[model samples]
Target: MPATGRENHTAPKAVYIHIPFCTNKCFYCDFNSYVLKDQPVMDYLRALDREMELTVRETPPGEIKTIFVGGGTPTVLNPQEMEFFLNSVKKNFPNWAEDIEFTMEANPGTTDRDKLAVMKAGGVNRVSFGVQAFQNELLSGIGRIHNTDDVYRSLENARNAGLDNLSIDLMFGLPNQTVEMLDYSVSKALELGLTHYSIYSLKVEENTLFHTLFQKNQLPLPSEEDELKMYQLLMDRMQAAGYKQYEISNFAKPGFESRHNMTYWRNEDYYGLGAGAHGYVNRRRHMNIKGVNPYVEAAMQKLPRLEQFSVPEAEAMEDFVMVGLRMLDGIRSADFAAQFGVSLEETFGRELHKMLSSGLLEEHEDRGGYRLTGKGVVFGNEVFAEFIGVLT
Candidate 1:
């Protein structure tokens, strides 16, 4: 058995493909992506195809359950390029589950009806749009190109093209954003009645424009008190709308959780393809080269790995608790023991006891494992931080 408790020979069921081109970079995004103009799109696609071919030959996949195509903006491809890319995916990883949940990320103004039709025809059943906010002023402040109208039009196009399993991403704690503004965004989002919503708070990541503004004290971010109020209101409103908070930042109707994302939260294995993608399989992890042309050149001859290494068992166990606890279901004792050949109590006894004593964690009522108390959810970072360096 693998360190992850799955059979070492069992093929990975999830795959992540990256498309590095977007129309423009958002102010707060630190993802490995580039603007579309002058990029060698076709050459990059062919390189990706080669990578997939090499990948499957080395680690032949089983019935693929999920494939997530993320990008600077995957939907930026024209129909022809989109068709070619999707066909390459089908050709290389042909054995898909009957109920596979293939998802592609898109920018609102980029996905037209024609492009969406091609996406649906090529086995993409889900589309997650980057509609960061409902307010145009906030959107502009964040360097997003789409207006509120583009969001509606894009959704209409997606539905019209037979892609109904839709999700939109919203952000709070943006510059000059008020609690009232967040409320308005959530209300407008709920009015769409989509199956999933991913609401995130702004983080001033290094290398992003927001981070520079923050350092210069030019970023007009909301106060910490107001941010807390916004989160409280968000949780209350999402629950009131009957959406389940399956993960910290994700809400879904029952049975509509993002299965692709679940693979990550559950600490399972997946293939990561394309420039700057990361993959973990058989207790080993690898990150692809980040630059597009450099990646293309590298993939032409061999696997374009920037770095790959085996994860130490102790570090892996720490990761298991940190990511698994992000989900509302939390980590179970049985699952933990299965992966590491040790009970959770035996491994994380002191940390668990400390959190439980602090009223931050409680044994799940219906489930056997421990979960966060309401207070813990708001302070989840603190709980997760407790586990770090405990094992190592």
Candidate 2:
């Protein structure tokens, strides 16, 4: 069970809705998604609606501050299905905040003008296009269905449909990629004049094509030194273009940062609906089952097929430090104290002292909180690992 005596507090401020259907899974992808052929799309949407209904029944919907519809590819759904899903969301959670940040993930090839207009009508104000690269060769190398033309057309379609707040995702260190390729990707993305960007370095996880290539020493990724240089170049270019690096991998025009992701980094409570979605509520963490059919069946019975566990206070403190440090502004000591009812130093003074001594972290003189220095951000995982269980 989750941490007891914490359930009577206010409801969550954010909600993450996962759509698990995709036209085709990319080669280097590991997210919970299924191919569209013969999949029960409508059934899954109904199940998702049921899950939302049950969640609101358990905890009345608070002022929803952010809602992100991510997934296999939200744009894969037909217009009617999209309408059904979005309607379910509005019907179940009617008390959305005035400035709610509603974002939906789209694929370049899947979205059309009509579909985007429907999305805009459904209260979606932001669209994130999955444009892994600007070159067709790189797109094919990564098994993405869309080419450069598709990306340009999609962005234009989004603008034509009146959805202006757009973001594009780019990847670095891809197979057969070079520094020049990365530069081209970023340059082309900027040319689109997007409001936000998420640039991620490829990680070779198990069951991914990249993982197989890595095991065989067949990957054509750039050298580590080159990769680091690429990262620096991206940061410099984005900053020069006036985009703020709110988090390590995300950049946005000032005041256009992603609110849904901020809810996660802030460790605030949120409802995660759909297969393989994770939720943090009432100081407890739960993960829904990853399979689509099982999730649907379980949700149909108004039961979350989830594994629930309470996050220990010590672990929570460590998590707070770890996640909060990911932001450029770093953790707020006052917020930590308020959440834990204990001074920040009282909880992790020794760990902070050790990290400070090692030059991996520095305390802000004016802010009076710890933040990662320039060198610290590169070794952030190392520093966070040290604080994980140091107090316990």
Candidate 3:
């Protein structure tokens, strides 16, 4: 109850539940998800329940401050199924914080009045709608079945259900995406009175449709210069709309920053439930089996399809630096020392000094630490790689 640390440390305050069923897979999405035409929805839920039970029995989490049910479109579940899934969550993790920030990811097409009500009743305080873009043409191009109307209707449903903590996701740098189109998407998302927004540039990941198109010389993504302009335009627009850029790709109204995601950025541990879910706790990281059938079978046998590895001290120290730097506030030196029982300089002195000299990172005067500069953010992978060498 006090928390988990040496003297006054606190236990992990976050939870992530993966719902892997979706109506259909998007062309650009490679997340662990499957199409749900005639899939055994109830059976999967039962397996998820078992998985949750087994997880809690192994390592019971403390009072949770945040719970994020992300997915393959969590709203794909029917009202009854949604209720069952959420209730199972409560039953499995009974001791949640009083002001728990419970968020659920909903696809615009699948969310309806009934589903919204069920989610609200199930303790989902925030709903993040995947609204990719405003234009119907772009939506279809991205293999999204929902039209603009579905976005409007879904927001209305959530508002009518008294769920006002809403966030909308948008994308830029898509094939054939223009600055004008990006503006329209941002304007439409603002018109919905969303409290948060997550806008990301498209990355052609391997095995995705976009990758295939790129290999075939058919991908029509924006030029690098245009993509840079789009990023600047979004930052300017969101700032004008009074949204705070809390993390790289996330903006929020005052007090609405994503608490669950902050857990990861802050390098804190949390439990990840369901297939393909990953977790970090007690200096160890693990991942659940990715395939649905394999996950279900493993859980039924009281064996999580999990692979655990102990994070070495040096790696953990560098991890603190890498993940904590993702936040705008940057890392705190004293906190890092307290957590690791070693000074920051003693661990990453050479890499930190080198990066600081290169203008890739700057020292945080208030926190006695370092954070990525604007230049570094553009080339963060390079900056992070330095820490890996330090670990070696």
Candidate 4:
């Protein structure tokens, strides 16, 4: 028996590749991406190839079910760079599932006909564009190089290249953004008639420009009331338009749900390749080196891993409950027992009872285990916080 890219061969069923290069840094972004200026571009690509080769040889993937290329912007890669990167991916983990969902995160202006064509030919079946807002001012405020026109142009280019399993990202709670602005963005997104929509609220994370602005009372973010209204309106509009809120932030048509993302929400193992990428396999988790030069130098011998640790069972169970609870369908009792060889009730009964009593968690009549109720969704952080290290 060999690894079929599943549990059979002790290999992860999913893979995540990181390309940490961007055209320019977004004010709201704090990801591990560097500016694409005077950097060793080809050296990084070759280093990624080296990392992939070393990784798959050691772990020897089974049959990869999903592969996601995420980054500062994977589309920032030129046609040649895109081809080279995808080639390394295929060479290292060749055995793929029949319906492997390959996705790449792209920016609007960076993606052109040639690069998209290269991507489609390189086994990327899905393209998720980062089109946060349709208004030009909003786009400029965020330091995003792409405009509304570029969004239209990029989508047209992606479609013309024969890639229609597409999705676009939207944001709410932006600086100087209004409820009407979110409504306009949603209208434009629905007008595109795409497959999926990932509408996320803006969180002012530390070390980001937005965070600094907030500390100085200069970031003109939407009022908390307005932000919440924006979220509620988005849910209503997407539901009216026939998209399912599959995850907290994601909405998709019936069959067009992001399989690659679901792989993470389901708490499955995945191979993480490239600099600053993270992977969880065989109950151990590790992140690659963040610096480009260090990762490249280290991959010549072994993976440029920054941290690695085996997950304890208690911690693993806590993770399962936290991540699994984010979906619309929620976690199941049967699935819990299958994974942990113990009943869900046996571990989180006290916690479940507490949430249920507070109307934050509800037992699904049809599917069994608990799910977040409508109120629970609003107070998700409160609910999730209770699960961490609960078993301990």
TM-score of each: 0.98, 0.96, 0.95, 0.96
Give one digit per residue, the lDDT tens place, for model 1 in 235-347.
Answer: 99999999999888999999999999999998989999999999999888999999999999999999999999988889989999999999988889888887877788988
Q: TM-score: which candidate is best?
A: 1
**Ranking under TM-score, best-scoring first?**
1, 4, 2, 3
lDDT of each: 0.95, 0.87, 0.86, 0.89
Candidate 4 lDDT, 140-235, residue by residue in tens: 999999999999999999999999999999999999999999999999999999999999999888888889999999999888899889999999
**Residue 269, candidate 4: alpha-carbon lDDT:** 85
* Local lDDT at 271 for model 4: 90
Query: Pairing residues by index, what is the TM-score of model 2?
Result: 0.96
Off by over 4 Å in 1: 1-7
Q: Which stretches of model 4 miss by more than 4 angstroms?
A: 1-9
The TM-score that candidate 4 achieves is: 0.96
- Please state every model's RMSD to the true fold in angstroms: 1.3, 2.4, 2.5, 2.7
Considering summed lDDT, which 10 consecutive residues are worst modelled in model 4?
Answer: 1-10
Higher-scoring candidate on TM-score, 3 or 4 = 4
Q: Which portions of model 2 show Cα errors greater than 4 Å?
A: 1-8
Looking at model 1, residue 248 earns an lDDT score of: 88
